[model samples]
Target: MKNILKVLRAERDWSQAVLGEKLNVSRQTINALEKGRYDPSLPLAFKISRLFERAIEEIFEDDKGEENA
Candidate 1:
């Protein structure tokens, strides 16, 4: 997945640690998410959605042309 997490955080002038604190996660987790090295769980996704006041789809996107069997 590709997400606009970094952009959103930047827009708000939030550090990774600040975002992590708001999301109840670690700074490393936020960094991983921003770097696309990890995917968030459903609950975490909802938390992010609520925090940003944006729909999950607006924040996270499924890579196109990828299909599951």
Candidate 2:
């Protein structure tokens, strides 16, 4: 999955630590998410979507190109 987490954080002028704090996660986890090294679990993904005021599909995208399926 690819997400716009870093971009959203940057837009809000939020540091990874701050974002982690808001999300009740760790800085390392934020880093991994920003780097696309990890995909968020369903619950965490919903948390992120709610925090960003965006839909899950708006934040995270499936790279499988299965939208047409």
In candidate 1, what are the lDDT values of residues 1-69, reduced to their tens digit? 799999999999999999999999999999999989999999999999999999999999877625642
Residue-level error in angstroms, candidate 2, position 9: 0.3
Candidate maximizing lDDT: 1
Model 1 regions lying over 4 Å from their true place = 64-69
How far residue 6's Cα lies from its native spot in candidate 1, in Å, is 0.4
Q: For every model shown, what is its TM-score relative to the native structure?
A: 0.91, 0.91
Q: Which portions of model 2 miss their true places by more than 4 Å?
A: none
Residue 42 lDDT, candidate 2, scale 0-100: 95
lDDT per model vs. reference: 0.95, 0.94
